[model samples]
Target: MEHSPVRKLLTEAGQRQVEARIKAAEAGTSGEIVVMVVEESSRYRHASVVGALFSSMIVAVAVGHFQGGDGMWHFLGVFVPLFIVFHELLVRFAPLRRLFARKGDMADAVGKASLAAFYAKGINGTEAATGVLIYISLFEHMVRVVADKGINEKVDPDAWPELVGGIVQGIRSGEAAAALSEAIDRCGELLSRHFPIREGDRNELSNQIRY
Candidate 1:
């Protein structure tokens, strides 16, 4: 089957890691599943960060207008450039890269679980768990996106911290999928209840991620 160039690239990247993990699994190496999930999650999370940062900046600007603060513009002028510079440094510097690497590991774990669910047979439990995780990570990213649009007041501040804690616990307990799914469901519920987006619009925004 023919695939889009972007899809082809993603498949190639995923295949490399999947192949390595399969080999490790066959060799009786434990943690192969976890490793695969982590790798994918990291890639997704990094992309999400870029999205979140830009979104946050836009929101900050809008909020500045309401508050009538020239300070906001000044902060934006200084920090936006600094942020861009820091992001470039992160791409180039090993230490900075490693430091922020784990920030998105939660997203990666759930993403891998979702993939595993699609490919692995008779392992519905893993698949289900991963599916939940993927949804949750997406939801978290959604919240960040919404926040960037100046909708922070719509979100409960406690939600993010709780979700992060759950992700960490899930990783520690080797139940990453379950933890991720729970977080996603909670976030989704909150979003639906407090900040409902039209299905068509939400899907439109989500589809952009594929590219």
Candidate 2:
């Protein structure tokens, strides 16, 4: 199986820390916050193909030079099978493909995944519709925040980039748990300022960490 850096980083103790962070983030607001970490956001098929093709071409040229090939038959013999094999090998190794993918492509995939989680995890179904999702894709080193309609109406979308930046710093430092904890505290401050705890507020979402 392919290695999942995110899962490995968030060990049992790290998961517990994230769960605690969620609880603390929700302490003073009706807004619900959910965090999700995933191994990757996309298959990056083009990236795999590009890497394989480029590498295979270089190797095939070297092979042909050594083999003293001139005709189409010799070139085909040296390059065709080698190209196929290398392409398959590269595609099979996800990390190699991910290495070739552009940052923009990865960001787009992360955005889509965040939206999917927003709905799949019932973040959009909260009673007050103040649900916020903090989604991280380890392979791409991307962070996304999805806010429900209720929160969007009141809070400017630009307000989230700073929070996301903090999380990114955590991931970069290899202290994902601490990074998320700090971000959650920041988010709590933001939510409490705008939403605050109401007289009959109730916890509407689970605080467990999602992987």
Candidate number of the best lDDT: 2
Q: CA lDDT, every prediction?
A: 0.40, 0.84
Report backbone clashes per prediction: 3, 0
Best by TM-score: 2
Q: How far is candidate 1 from the true structure (C-alpha RMSD, Å)?
A: 17.5
Write down the RMSD of candidate 2 (Cα, Å). 2.2
In order, what is each prediction's RMSD in angstroms?
17.5, 2.2
Question: Which regions of candidate 1 deviate over 4 angstroms?
Answer: 1-146, 197-202, 207-211
User: Across residues 85-190, which tens digit of lDDT does each residue of candidate 1 receive?
Assistant: 6666655654445544554564455545555533442222331121111222322221111122222455566666666677566656655445544554554555
> Any residue pairs clashing in model 1, and if so which?
41-108, 132-181, 136-184
What is the overall TM-score of model 2 with all chains considered together?
0.91
Q: In model 2, which regions exceed 4 Å deviation?
A: 1-6
